[model samples]
Target: MADPTDLNLPEEREHVYKQQNDDVPASSLNSTPSSSWWSSLLAASGLVSPLDFAFVLFSVVYIFFLGKFAFPPQSDDPSKDPPVFKAEGIMVKTGPAFGAVLGLALPIAYIFHGVLEGDQEGIEAAVPHVFLLASQAFMDGVAYSDRFSTPIRVFMPVFFSAKKIFTLMDWVGNEFSKVCVGGGCDAAAERRVLLGRGLAVANLVFWSLDLFC
Candidate 1:
């Protein structure tokens, strides 16, 4: 006996339909938790590159080597020998600053820029030198500790710098190839290529001089 218009059936049906749609299915809710957690874990793992892992491994080995072999007997004074080369004033201040810029800042900037530009070759070329330089810095710190002798302190830099020269050579070659590629690139790309080449050459020169001089 109810009038269809008075019943407002369309509106009532729409409200019911919306309520059904709004109710989340238990299976969907249950499925998302495990999948999301796994996805987050994978994302985190992907962020750490192989170079980073290598750097960490190298640091551990380098430190272990220093502790096990580089260290002198407890009775023997490690500091008995005179310091190999002492830095005073400007050399002490500017030396570390220059090293930090070349080793840490420049490579990091180049790596980030390469990532943004999708330059995989450039990134690959720069990464080895970055990690090697970082490892050198780590070993240098370890060498400076009182447990190591003067000779060990001197040896660390000389050895690492020699290794770094080879890395720089590879980097320079990679950048040079990029710059000279047959098809011409855009202005921004050209500028980046030139800058990268120049930086690589500069590092090559600097490290060569550091190792030999």
Candidate 2:
């Protein structure tokens, strides 16, 4: 057996140790402290943004209100009123409704103007933004549903859901153009026809809900 002492062992060991130390990262020396790791991870994940959390809380509260108040109790008495609700001002009732009508009007006018002028390009450019604003206004309309006493609540959800469908179709037509090739083919044409049909159905549903119940 060779003598271990004569193998240049100490210098090689020192060189190896130096190289290993050089290669090792400084972060490995002190791990992320347990106390702050969760917070750091949350910050890095963007799980605590103000807007995100605000919307989350708002959605929860909004749904809670929906479940609590939307469907009223049935009673045998004709004299019994459904439910009474009041808001601070007429502005509350008028604002969102007017906004919805205007939002709907702008895009519709744009599209019609384009049709009349044979400017398909212009109509294509403007309609999606109109649908988005209309959706927001529709949501506002729902948020104030109880405030409007004359029309009643039966049509509210149907209208709101129609707005939702409109918004979704707009997104599919505009944002997901890559998926459908910007309505250039048969499939895209089908989608547009489907959207028109859906809008018609939504209108029917709202009117039906208003008339019967």
Candidate 3:
């Protein structure tokens, strides 16, 4: 019988004494992870990426804005109860609420389908993102409404100088587009993901000083 050690190449024999711990999996070495983004981001910056934080922030903010904020009650004494909300504000909120539901619902349905097909890698990430964008859209709609803004002047005269809500509308719309596009296992998925992240960075840049409506 031939000795196995005798079959080793000269280079392999010389390096055989060293530890051979290079047991990386081919899948990891060859392709990017479906959502290694969070850890990779933390590794690179020693903090959560602004976009990831923004995604959660917008979700929490808009959820509170839409589902929880209490408007000041109307009163006979104008000074005592400044008009900060209007009847139309309630009606105006519907559009964004509907948009938010639809935005969140669409991706959730997609995730459900993926689960049925046994692709569980992305279902968790996609669900909250769509919800966040939807919330942002809702905030945009409410804040931009004159019905909501008209009354704020009495409470905080300098709250909105002019046309600022419209700016929020535009920024949220831009973000909504990114979240809308950032899904699926299509060929352009990587690009869509990057653009969706840009939405978060944009939020930090443009929507950081957001005013409550």
Candidate 4:
């Protein structure tokens, strides 16, 4: 007995919608949820969420595009005024891909950092040799600058030589930054790597466990 156009119920609504398909605006279709609302709902889900997945996926694709298509083609060109620092260019363009790699590597690095502490001793012991080598070049410059009888003349010229002074200071500063006592350095790098990996793995495991609760 109800009017054919009476679209109060679901069936009637669909019928009316179909009837008005030509006349109805595209926005009035079975589009119940608004786009923004739907997107938020999808985003609320984990990495399984389509919206979040698509965003990350597209972003990664864009990075690949930049690296493969944009950056190397343009930046690596020898014709560029000042050649782009290839390492920095690659880093910026491939950041997302690199980040994902680093994320996994970070945890592993941390777990093994303390174990690798002894490896740095060999590396640290080589520092004094580096300094000694660097000093030889610098002292040679000082000796060569000894044209004047005035000792200050030789000393000042060597000290003021930006390249020579920088070389010596760089070696000394780098060695001290390693946190060595006398001839040995601390495990600072290893400790940091270990802490990062441990925390990352801990958080990831905790999050997975919490999901069941």
Candidate maximizing lDDT: 1
Q: For candidate 3, lDDT tens digit of each residue in 1-213?
A: 221111111011111111122353312222222122322332344233355446445544543354335443244322222233333443333432343233333444545564675544344345344333433332333332222322332322122212234433443454445443535556555554454445434433332332333
Which parts of model 4 are misplaced by more than 4 Å? 1-53, 56-186
Q: What tens digits encode model 1's per-residue C-alpha lDDT throughout 122-213?
A: 87788767666655554555554446655555666776787778788988988987743445788778878888988899888877866775
RMSD of 3: 24.9
Model 1 residue 29 lDDT?
21
- Give Cα-based local distance difference scores for all models: 0.57, 0.36, 0.34, 0.31
Quality of model 2 by C-alpha lDDT: 0.36
Per-residue CA lDDT of candidate 4, range 71-179, in tens?
4323232121221123334433443233223322332233245347644433332222222222222232222221212232223222323322333343334434544
What value does the lDDT take at residue 29 in candidate 2? 26
TM-score of each: 0.64, 0.28, 0.26, 0.17
Candidate achieving the largest TM-score: 1
Where does the lowest 10-residue lDDT sum fall in candidate 4? 4-13
Question: Candidate 3, 94: how far from true, in Å?
Answer: 2.3
Compose the digit string of candidate 2's lDDT tens values, residues 49-109. 4543344345435644653576343443211233232333453334333433433443455
Q: What is residue 124's positional error in candidate 4, in angstroms?
A: 26
Better of 1 and 3 by lDDT: 1
- CA lDDT of 171 in candidate 2? 35
Ranking of all predicted structures according to lDDT, beginning with the best and ending with the worst: 1, 2, 3, 4
Worst 10 residues of 3 by lDDT: 4-13
